[model samples]
Target: SLALGPSGAWSRCAPAAATRRRSDSDAVGRQAGMFPETMSVFGNRWAAALLVAAFLETTRFTDFQTQLGAPPSLLAERLQTFCAIGVLSSSPAERSGSERSTYLLTDKGRALFPVLVAALQWAQQWFRAPEGPAIALTHRGCGAGFTGELACDRCTELLAGAQISVVAR
Candidate 1:
């Protein structure tokens, strides 16, 4: 079983793994995995919403607050974090002196498009939408409504969970 340790690291704490106490190095590794880190970022609703909104072309600080209903302080914090991590870039919205800045997703952030697409596909499959989808996307290239599919880069074959494997580098 996986559980969050008292120190805030996720530990595999069932069976034999639980019997042995974790060392400092192991504890550090627990927090270093990319999957956990990515989850940590996306798990914050404000952060996730901000990224999605950036993809949808919402750039201003005020627009993010209005769209996500995030408090000013919290929104600022999340935006700062994103900027620090190089996921988003901020620039003055105008040449004239103004406090406002436009936030745009950086190339690093744009690389996350596949993950976002997968998540949207999963949500559409599993979540109920009595009022229909809040947002429907259209593909400019295809000139039709967009539906994402995961595929292997080499073979271009459609992929599913069973077809994928996680291997450490």
Candidate 2:
């Protein structure tokens, strides 16, 4: 909500719902506790940029640097973070003589394929772009366009936030 202050400048107000917790069980609080560790792998400033580039086949350190236009130090830091977490595998670019190393996506890193796709799908739908999306993904096997739905395996239906339930399992 917006409010006009005494000086006449509009001040934004937080909605009441924003201040209220959804349940007494601290679901959000519990999630917040896990976020730092989660973000340590997924929440850095250039994380999406770097991971998207990697998903698109950028392998060499120099190539990632060039494509991302990120400073080498920051890029190296992100690469190190991924390496430490087992998301990427690095090998000497020159097996016997080269000083450079090549980075490859591990199965862990490759698992983010759907995540990247869902991110793009969400942004394209909810955010307006002046120049349209950067890229589109197509299913290679049957050439079907993606809908980015988190479908349920049991019912084979699209799932939304309210459709979910949490158990301490």
Best by lDDT: 2
For model 2, the run of ten residues with the poorest summed lDDT: 9-18
Cα lDDT listed for each candidate: 0.63, 0.64
Instruction: Kindly list the per-residue Cα lDDT of model 2 for residues 67-167, writing each as its tens digit.
Output: 66666766787787777666788988866888898999899888877787787678666754455445556666777655667989999988998999988
Tell me the spans in candidate 1 whose CA falls farther than 4 Å from its real position: 1-37
Q: Say what the RMSD of model 2 is.
A: 12.8
Give me the candidate number with maximum TM-score.
1
Query: lDDT of candidate 2 vs native?
Result: 0.64
Could you tell me every candidate's TM-score relative to the true structure?
Answer: 0.75, 0.74
In order of listing, the candidates' clash counts read: 0, 0
Clashing pairs in 1: none
